[model samples]
Target: LGRWINPDPGGTIDGLNLFRMVSNNPLTLRDRSGLRGSGYIYVPFLSRDTVDIAIALYTQKYAVNKKPDIVVFSSRNEQLDFYEELKKRRSDFAAAMGKSLFEKYNTSDLSRKSLLNAGVKETEIKSTIMSIGNYLAINSMTLMNQQDDEIFSEISIGDKLKIIGHGSAGSAEISSGGLKSVTLSMHELAERLDFSGLPDQALQITLLPCQSGDELLEPVFIEGKSPFMRTRPSAAESLFYEMQARGYRRVTTAGYRGFGQIRGFLESTGSHHTQRKPNSITASDDIVRRRDAKEIFC
Candidate 1:
């Protein structure tokens, strides 16, 4: 395959594959909502470059003042690997310990007092539970520090974290493997990430995925009857809500409900159902939190 230069190369996000769509493995990898084409199949959206989108975000949101603390270009393979390994570890831990105990450790505080009260030792708990940063570093494909296993053992991600990946309404799709592929749920991700070290009202997390900001209508079944009416937060919203529930306050999370795309230097502000109109530059963080036709920040 012939290589192509990205049209909008200003402040391109990462050094990996700056000019390739689907990581130049167009035959296998699936790029959804974030990119335009794979091989000869030219989709009629915007640029098929995730780097372009990330650059737009950076130019508009974080780079104006200081560079983002952590920028994660989460590839499908790495996401899948992390999800699979995390899932395996969860299952294995649950098996070794009881399901209830595992749930308590993950849900309840792992503080010394809490662990002691629960008849668990801090040393044993830490030994059994693998550090998430270590897993991410070991499995990362893009830029990641191999020594983060120790660097982030007790610390949370710094102020800002930007993740660009294939997303859906409810989860970050980790694979192009469709149903057989793994997915990381919003709640699971929120629970797994370390957020305890962030200063009050300082953490900012941005997620670029299709309809990741759209809310869901969960039917409230009553006596197994009809006319059940209820609504719930979208995946991104749930992530924020989960963070709040876990005592992280004043943290901002950004996501998009539309099929987010970029044309040249501007982000496509058009809604999901209609053709994108790139008339103005809308920064990802500046997007208004809405159910449709815009971005959501919570």
Candidate 2:
């Protein structure tokens, strides 16, 4: 809705060219503030392309796959929950690793040396670690995605399982069904994703087109009640509101429950050992949800 944001009507009516799309390439215009139109206006956003390379990678992977596929119904809930739980379970995981390989991982402090003691390869641990408040900033973007199916499209129910997680090691070899423990390095995860038929360029311009007469790809995203811990990205909600304002119908929602879609996705892929489906219901929007940003932030 760039056109809707056009405050000035002085432009020509023969299809106004008010907001020119800056070439997706990098530009120095943002650093140079002379381009700022007025005290209330700035062009920093023009330099940042809204395209999502992650989604593009998925679409590219989908295009290259030639084999028959079993499209599953699990949403992205399980993995999201796993990640959230991981943050809480880090110490536990470290303890487990330490018991397996001591001295190298426990360096008398929770440091990079701890990972080394835990038998984590040098590359698995980040070269540098930084923390802000309660959040520990890592060296990778992570294995997060729209759904677990997006990552495991190459595997099936009865195939030999080769799985990966942000932390763990060794491909587990067992009977027909058992949870394996193999950790994933950040760089390794990105590399594996590249090999998974996901185009590397998808990270920059992952686009999905509309049926027709629509300018942008629109998706319906059902979100959880907690804003701070939402499975879907923040942009999805903004787009939903923008589409709503544009009179679009058919709002997109996840599986039945608010936070259950992610959980379902995990259970579908054996990510969660005690996987259980979420229970949800159809409901109308709450008008007061928008009054305060804090209402959703947490």
Q: What's the TM-score of every candidate structure?
A: 0.40, 0.18
lDDT of 2 by residue, 226-269 (tens): 33422323322333333344443322211110121112111122
Query: Best candidate per TM-score, number?
Result: 1
Candidate 1: segments with Cα more than 4 A from true spot: 1-70, 73-142, 146-159, 170-180, 195-200, 218-224, 265-298
> Pairs clashing in candidate 1?
36-48
- Pick the lDDT winner: 1
Task: Sum up the clashes in candidate 1.
Answer: 1
CA RMSD of all predictions: 22.5, 22.7
Give residue 115's lDDT in candidate 2 (0 to 100): 35
Against the hidden true structure, what lDDT does model 1 obtain?
Answer: 0.42
